[model samples]
Target: MKHPKVINLVQEPEVFYRIQNKYDRIISVLGGSMQVGQVVNSDIDLIDITRRGLPKSVVITVSLILGISMEKMSSLLHVSHRTIQRKGDDELLNVYSTEQILEIAEVISRGIEVLGTLENFTKWLHSDVRALNYSKPLDYLDTSFGTKLVKDILGRIEHGVYS
Candidate 1:
């Protein structure tokens, strides 16, 4: 019998799919007259947008997407609710606030993607999570570490390993 030819195989360091997430295209989280054609496709794009600042309407849109009140959104951004409400829709938010809002939108997008719908993800956000020591995921929204934790859990849930 002839010896079989063996082919050396190497795995790719990163998987490349021709397809990309549609979410990155619309970035609907930045709602209100945002042109979906201009997508946030890279870290540099994210940084540039952050430096440019987001409109005040982003806060309102994200709050609605999250089904939370502006008062709650205000507390998360560490700003007065009145200040947020007083700002015009076209007014740009401060860099720090813009960054925070962007981060939150990222998490929201991931959660919705993983959970299959915004309604389901919103419910999950408010529900107490066992891995989070019975604290609601919403409670973790105030801190960066906690937001990361939420993202990790969402990843786990996506992979079917979240117990």
Candidate 2:
């Protein structure tokens, strides 16, 4: 008998908060928030370390660092807007069909280098030194949570995980 496929619930608030916790932890250990002056340097450092070239993952990193929309990055990369949207959608939705998983696996296997030392992963959770400085009230947390999730994902990548 075929078992029912387990549906992954995309509960935005809870999911975002969890991502935020992970991201904040990384930044805390890293000393401070990454600044504009440091973005270029950090990007190059990560690129050299990963040596996997840029893929959908880079788009997310670039977005967080530059505070730009995914659409703009998609245009620059010459990848379709839908593809960009799909990546973010999948991330937020936390849904990975067999086909998408296969695609991700194929991409990473192409140049599987370091899988991120545990130490590196810890560095990403710290507070932002070159912070975005986006203010938010404590009462309204969902927005902050989403930002945290994005930051956390970046931290994971810094640790060299494909996520």
Candidate 3:
């Protein structure tokens, strides 16, 4: 008689997270906010969206809430010091910090399954400012609770879900 194979749940964060996330995505899809394929495709699109929009917002929000300097934020995000100035807001210097950019980068890096080349990441970072603005992309933030939601979203994406 042969015994069935046993699955170890403690040895792999990716596998553990994948199952947990798939369950969560199933529930969310059933709720009608997303389709089944979208959940699966999210693995790819999330990296795309993150590369395209999240970094700037993460840097901006963190700097704003922490009241830090843009030069610092740039160094931390590995972006040019001029990037913040280009945001068209003098106040941005008072909001972002180097530490915050590092924190956000670490979080985002974990979810990037198919990392583009450095040039690709840089190009993607500066894309479609008009779309980013109209998405009211940052409106999801206003308070600590909102920030928590952003963190949660990142966690979901890392795990392969959105909830």
Candidate 4:
């Protein structure tokens, strides 16, 4: 079965709050309230979010939520550790890095659906898995191909397929 489009945490107050509990910085970026007269009639503008580039805070928030370190985040984005460290909290990541970060967030949203909680999903990400040649799921998060592989595995798990 195909997974649903990930909710726009920026637009959905409930979902945003839920995520905020784990990634505290999200509230600052997305704002504490849904904007006045904002309509939730359609899916989130993934292109726009990517084009605008994600703030460095988003990268840090996601890393913390996933229980991954800043070093791991740098490797995943193929950016240097020092460069990531040098960026200001509000600085925007480049388009490529922003897209990858969004992709990871989407995956985390899906994983939560299947695994029940951020804590469980994060644990799964860090643990070795038989399906991935005994490699931790996080080991493959550094590249597009690997991200796809990990997503596929999550999809399989969601469908109750033995990996």
lDDT string for model 4 (1-163, tens) is: 4422233443452453354232222222233213111222223545666676777877776777677789988998999989999999878889899778766765776667668766687899999998999999888877778888988999999889997
Indicate which candidate wins on TM-score: 1
Ranking by lDDT: 1, 4, 3, 2
Off by over 4 Å in 2: 1-55, 88-163
Name the better of 1 and 2 by lDDT. 1
lDDT-better candidate, 1 vs 3: 1
Compared with the true structure, all predictions reach lDDT values of 0.70, 0.31, 0.36, 0.67
- Over the stretch 95-131, how does candidate 3's per-residue lDDT look in tens digits? 2342233334333232222222222322333343242
Badly placed stretches (over 4 Å) of model 1 are 1-26, 32-38
Worst lDDT run of 10 residues, candidate 4, spans: 32-41
Q: How many backbone clashes does candidate 2 have?
A: 14
Residues 1-163 of candidate 1 have per-residue lDDT tens digits of: 4422221101110111111343342255555225222346567777877788888877877787777899999988888999998899878888788778878877887776788766788899989899999888887786678789899999999999963
Candidate 4 TM-score, true structure as reference: 0.75
Candidate 2 structure quality by residue, lDDT tens digits, 1-163: 4422221112121222232232222222222223111122233443332342333443454334323466654443445668666664223211222222222222221111122322232233222322334322111112334334444445555576664
Better of 1 and 2 by TM-score: 1
TM-score of each: 0.80, 0.23, 0.28, 0.75
- Cα RMSD of predicted structure 3: 16.5
Model 1, position 136, has a per-residue lDDT of: 84
The residue ranges of model 4 lying beyond 4 angstroms of the native Cα positions read: 1-44
